[model samples]
Target: MRKFIQSIMLLALSAQLFAQSSDWVYATMTHESALSLQSSHPSGIVILATEGNVSAVQIQHQLAPSLKSGNLHGPGYIYRTDAQDAVQALTKNAPKKFNILDFTITEDMFVNEVLGMVSQENLGNTILELENYGSRFHTTSSGRQAALDLKEKWQEMAQAANREDITVELFQHQLTQQRSVILTIPGTEVPNEIVVIGGHLDSGDWSLQTNAPGADDNASGIATMTETLRILLAKNFHPKRTVQIMAYAAEEIGLVGSNEIATQYNNQNKNVVAMAQFDMTNYNGSSVDVGLINDAQFTSSELNLFWVELMEHYNSTGEHRITYGTTACGYGCSDHVSWTENGYLASFPFESSFGEHNPFVHSEEDTFAAMNNDASHSVKFVKLALEFVIEIAKVSTMSTQELNKTDIQIVVQNRDLIYQFNSSNKSLNSMAIYDSSARNVLSKNQLNASGRISLQGIPSGYYIAVFKDNQGKSHSKKFLLK
Candidate 1:
């Protein structure tokens, strides 16, 4: 009787192993990462092929629960297709060797002007608005609406700036209903070279139809990007290299959106210079203010060094000083992995260390109130992003040549506004100040020859000073009243 029972159990186990459905999906991940997943749940994963340090595996959709749970705990796998396809993709897009650009600091004044416009209130409001959605999970109706709403918001901002060069569009994917959003600002000088800054917009939990307020997991990251876009448009800033702000969809489900987009860009032979991903930027669970992922397999050492140098030069010491430490998120943790696999230089600046990430992520508990209902932590990331864009995509001379030629300087000191011109040919006829919302606060039709005006009743905050020259051309500068 004991022998018969053993045989029956063995037969059942074999049947279970071979009875898997044809709904299996192919993916490629590091050998170590694949082994870790299989060791944790032997019945959930199967390795199909291996080449060098990478392995291709066939996974069932039923294992989504395990994958989602493991994402909250340890490293995750990179999703791709068939073993042959995976190897071919890797070979076709093998990373090219190139020299790192010269790290220099020549745009201090422009960088400072943009960094001063960072607002905590704006970031918090964005987070609140995104959390109001039912769920941003892929394949859901709400997820698709969220993407459409964001597209409209970006289009409105571009219109307000009166810029015809800026274009906003939705990137549709074949696998998921939720579409990714892309806002492109065409470069003035180097239109071929591209720079990308992105974060995932979709959120998830155990249930797809119910509540899954992923405020900290990803809403925070999207908020950071939105605030950056807001300030850049308000300042009427134009870059020399094409800059794109991408809000990817379906990141929670094995980086599906980003992988498809990256693969397409690679196939087109797009010249993407560098990419940066901001995911989970609100929660401060670690000792340091910023955590820079230093994994060489999925990140660029040169890119990491560039950010470190930026921090040392721009945010070294002050009330807004940001301290950073190195960390690693195994393999295929976020959207940055997608870009890295496509032979692009990408970097991820995380909110906290690996083991110290937010404990309430991927559930209803990941709400704004869970992080003390504040966006102060995200302010640092906004500042860092400003510095990155200003340095990488230097200001375009075509758009600001008039102002550059005039060389006008405006300063506010002790309730008095002073203006000076390095070129004697330029003369200021009228001056006005506008708030960040583009509302004109104070205006003066006539000005004294001494180039001074009294700001007696103006409040202390961020404002843009617009000066009209004798030629009827306008020049603006951002200033803070303290």
Candidate 2:
């Protein structure tokens, strides 16, 4: 009897192992790519069906690492159930044509106000808070908590801004335990036309355990979007087009969250005018300050040009100026691909060039301290996001007339910086200067009627001059220090 009981236990264990090993997931990729994957991992992958250039494939769960590495089919593959489902998803996911509008920078005063409100301290704090999580893996409890926490934070922001109409909700996924967070600010005018900005919230590592910090891989991107949200809410920005900020889940594993959301929007015929993605924004791994993904197959060229033109108009001259270059991220590199694949105009501005992205990503070492504990690099992307949303969404009721009325100007003469304020109702209480990284380098409390300050020791670069008035309102102007 004892021998028979032991044999039964052993057989049960073996059955369980077999079940786990046989677990497979359906995905969509190019026909050639699917064939190549199957050839490379003969027993691990199987081609299910083919429709033109695309093919439905079934991959063993154990071979996910091999699929993720080597950029086999890009950073992610759209998860599906069977060949029929994958084919339907592909057929309905046709790209849409976009009516490219003028990418000009028209809201200078409002844009400047929002850009100046971007705080590196806030960004750093958010990144650190996110890193505190053990690991935001899609199937982990911490991952779901992260999404819930973000939802609460966004709700608090909306309440603080007194925009009670703003709605924040969790977009649950069927495949993953983690949920995506969405915060929407309804437009006063064209509510149907939507503008989206997003980044992944889930982090990952090789072991799929609870050690991945992903501070730069995606925490920085989320932090950037958070800061952007804070400033927009603080200013009570009313836009003509609806603005939605999303924190996607399961991006590290097959871009699952964003793909579902984008597909739903596409099927519902949501008019998403523009979508922007911020990923790995904290690391400056390249010479260029900003690298705009130029993959024509997955990104909109017209939208990319609009970003360049917008930067040149608003951030090109002073310390706020950022250098941009074109780089390509292969198929399904990030969540932007979800929008692009669904026929939406999407763009992704990265921290570095394609090959130069932060090497620490998808590892335990990707921490805030690893990037020198600095949020300066992420600040540039925050400014870019602000520029993109403000210009594309088109402010509706937010008035810059008060700012226009206050004639504040800064002129550089030799080594002295001169400020001229003509508004009689607003008295300049204090003045300060900040560098391109938003670091406060010079500050002065006592203001004389002369309105002159010396910049003898300050370095030559782009700097912003900020003036605080008696009413506690701050005004800023960008100037070149030489």
Candidate 3:
């Protein structure tokens, strides 16, 4: 009878695991009736343990409808859970002893993405910044001067190197008193719909005195975009959407510079598809995996699908764990927030476990060697990031497209507002519009798949409409009338 009971338990366990549902009870172990109560059976490593009891029960019974929902405790546990049937069968006749032991569980784990430029050839060019960064990471005239130097070098290359394909512009923001370097790769067919990738070029020491090289802080991100540009240029991949890459100024001063551009796009209602922040992508050895710190406002099913699929991809391809960090809509610790808060699928990726903790950061020693490590871990981080970009920047259905206020008049009879877009590409799937003043007016409903949106019943005012293409790209336009 005892042997029969054990067999029945095994069968029940198998059924529960196959379903992988949290709607029923699932127990790890119980003193009263675990088949192995008498002797130990091989099980997953005990990352979570009980203090005094030889055995403990992890009963996962449903509570009130409002208590909570999903996976035993969500994706935060290490071991696989037992099938619900197994829990039910064992608990059916178990005494009170089975329900009383103290227990614990492990916290969620995830993989990290290395975001900076670290390719071998680019690595050769980037390492020069480590040796030549003038030994300081301040927003000094020296720093701005360094930025100027980059512009000059690239300008010379764009002309003499016969590389006019890459146009680099320096924008000195009048409002924020900061500098912005915008790089554009105009689309061959769809030149208006835009796809933008950005990183803050500013680096800083927390003390604001010492010269922190900020190699990993952002040089990594800058390098990645630059190298990514080089790769795309070499491949001659003509995206249906125009691509814009930016190196923002004053990021260390609390993302002020990026905020200027983000807010600019926000105000104009520029068509923006997906904006990504590639900060601190190199030199982390911690086991913690990549972080997808996304704001909650987007709640777009498409955005949610991207994150879920991205993490699932990492779990299958690598050994690290990946997870979502926060739940609130207005919470994020990186430059992506500027885009996220304005209704874009903005996000930042981090590799280190304690996100805001960098011991050598903001110091002269925050050089390439500090985070540009070549450990096995580093290799995975680099590969994961590179692959992620390759996948993300490959939107193909329609290039970003933006229409002028005149175009808006032709489409809608409201005749009450003016529309303007940074660029409206000739393609279909992606686009964005910035309403420098009326950004919050667009989320009328779930416009996730609304190809041709209507703005009826809306108060007459200037507005920007940003259309993000379905195929991983975006475009924007401004509107005005009456």
Candidate 4:
């Protein structure tokens, strides 16, 4: 009976191991690639699917070295987990808990710090430079070079900001020499809880060593995210949770780089609060300014709802009024799926709907010019990305003393500023909106009995929302118009 029980346990372990779907993945390599010999796969390995039984660490050591120098047609290769397989493996028997929204939105100081920092000129320049790289096909020399260049660029930006807390790193993967660039801002309070914003850096035209500018396909995403980082650094915005900005490598071929990174993070039980992805963000192909991907298989509904609420609050009353809609990009179409499969909340905000997406992507025609030589559309994404970070990371300390004194909740609703006072003891005598320089932009001397104050014709900026209570106490809250 003891021997039978032991055999039963062994059978159960074997069943679990074999049933792991993430182990069944695909490799993009020809028969001549060195990875072919290392893989237990048969010949003619063009997009071959294999089930790897090795540990993550063992796989990295066994496969990563040989992958350092190969192209699609040469002795190198790129590998990625099968999208469906990964999703199945990770979600099997997983609880369907909708994580509670547990964050506050108050950071006018951080908002003010970012003004004039997300430069359209700078964004255009970054896109142009990346386009000039000719191609960033995962296995090509230019691809690796582009990744290294981006790493250096981020490092310079951090140094220029004189921020020692920000560390830019190259996250190496086993698929290609191209390493993902990671910029981390360690949280002042909860450093372990993380918020991530990502975009893919590599571009391709379904061929290696080709001129795939991919300006709209992904350079726009990277440039927009870069601006977000620059502004955050410029403002010296410190949050309660770590904020990570990522530029993924080899995304055009498969979700290779991000898959490895997300898997490692999951295995280590990292507390990733949320992840937002920016991809193909420049081309305004649709009527809406942004399209939040609603694919249930590849996105988090709870997190996406937060984004909708954020837009409704910020973009509703601002001069730069942003319009948004929901669309679906199929599973594993981008890197956000990598995080999603690993049981982390992720979102993808695309430039437009699927039917109206930039048509020139993954081709030589995907140039900066293809995006009409404008970074205006992409600028909206930067705004959204920065706001996402602030909301998820939360403020380390309240910037306004009134926030501590009053139970008044403030938000923009339907192009009107609504201030909801929940405290029966607090009666508003007066209210005013002052710009960043403390200049009174809008003022009201009378307050209605309803305990709600609505204002209109206010522009987007950092402002001091000052309310005078009946007790003659001046309560002030820092407010961002959008």
Q: Which candidate is the best by lDDT?
A: 2
Candidate 2 matches the true fold with a TM-score of 0.76
Q: Can you give the lDDT of residue 50 in candidate 1?
A: 60
Better of 2 and 4 by TM-score: 2
Q: Write the per-residue lDDT of candidate 4 for residues 106-217, one digit (tens) a residue.
A: 5545654554356888889989999988888777788889889998999999899888888999998876789999999999988999999998888873443478787876
Error of 3 at 67 (Å): 32
* Candidate 2 Cα errors over 4 Å, as ranges: 1-23, 30-36, 49-53, 61-74, 93-97, 102-104, 398-482
- lDDT for each candidate structure: 0.75, 0.77, 0.45, 0.67
Cα lDDT tens digits, model 1, 214-322, are 8887999899999999998987888888999999988876788888898898878887888899989998989988888877778876677667656655775665588
Per-residue lDDT of candidate 2, residues 314-344 (tens digit): 6655668787777865445788888988899
Give the poorly placed runs of model 1, Cα more than 4 Å off.
Answer: 1-23, 61-75, 87-93, 205-209, 398-482
Q: Please estimate how well model 2 matches the true structure, expressed as its whole-model Cα lDDT.
A: 0.77
By lDDT, is 2 or 4 better?
2
lDDT of 2 at 156: 94
Clashing pairs in 4: 70-76
